[model samples]
Target: MSRRLEFSPTVRQKIIERDQGCFFCRRLYHMEHALPGDLAPKDIMHVVARSHLGLGVEQNGVLGCRYHHSLLDNGNKGLHREMDSMLQDYMRELYPGWTPDSVTYHKWL
Candidate 1:
């Protein structure tokens, strides 16, 4: 069985700082499409699920608001591609030797 990782406070803080806010779902609502604001707390989500052997390291983590977290956990149809792209960019920026193929973001999806 695959194991899940618990983030240390330092790691969690780093992720929060890096992501700033939800990796997905940030947008301007037009006058005709205004919706209630959400302060949904961010969650560190696994790019490749633990069940599928994804690690619990920062490289595999994506910051997601609660709603998006559940969507990913439950395999609900959602905006995962955006999240994957963001994470890919982040990892590449922070870890110079890291390659896109080094992580498994698309296979699980």
Candidate 2:
């Protein structure tokens, strides 16, 4: 059996409300599997990638649909940078300890 991340119902609701829907298109995502058997809760890609430098908090994350997530991962530099900046601002306000240097924004892309 595979282990699944179990987030508190309150946390999940907060995430949904924070994004106010989709992080990219700002629309309501129907909450489905990205593919056929993925168990993830289905969220948007972090503009500044959690693995790369994202803060690993709700503010650092976006609520993108699978399509936008793909576009971000496939090196869609332009949109990626734009979203990164937006998320960064939100993070700075949410996390006072967050420094700009903590994450490198690829604005040129």
- Top TM-score prediction, candidate number: 1
Q: Which stretches of candidate 2 lie over 4 Å from their true place?
A: 1-12, 27-44, 92-109
Every model's TM-score: 0.60, 0.51
CA RMSD of each candidate after superposition: 5.6, 8.8
lDDT (0-100) at residue 102 of candidate 2? 53
* Per-candidate total of colliding backbone pairs: 0, 2
Please write out the lDDT profile of model 1 over residues 48-78, one tens digit for every residue.
6665565566776767766666555654455
Which 10-residue window of candidate 1 scores lowest in summed lDDT? 27-36
For candidate 2, write residues 1-109 as lDDT tens digits.
Answer: 0111223455556677777655655432222424533323456445456445543345445565566576567645455565556667766777787655554334353
Tell me the deviation in Å of residue 67 in model 2: 1.6
**Candidate that would win on lDDT:** 1
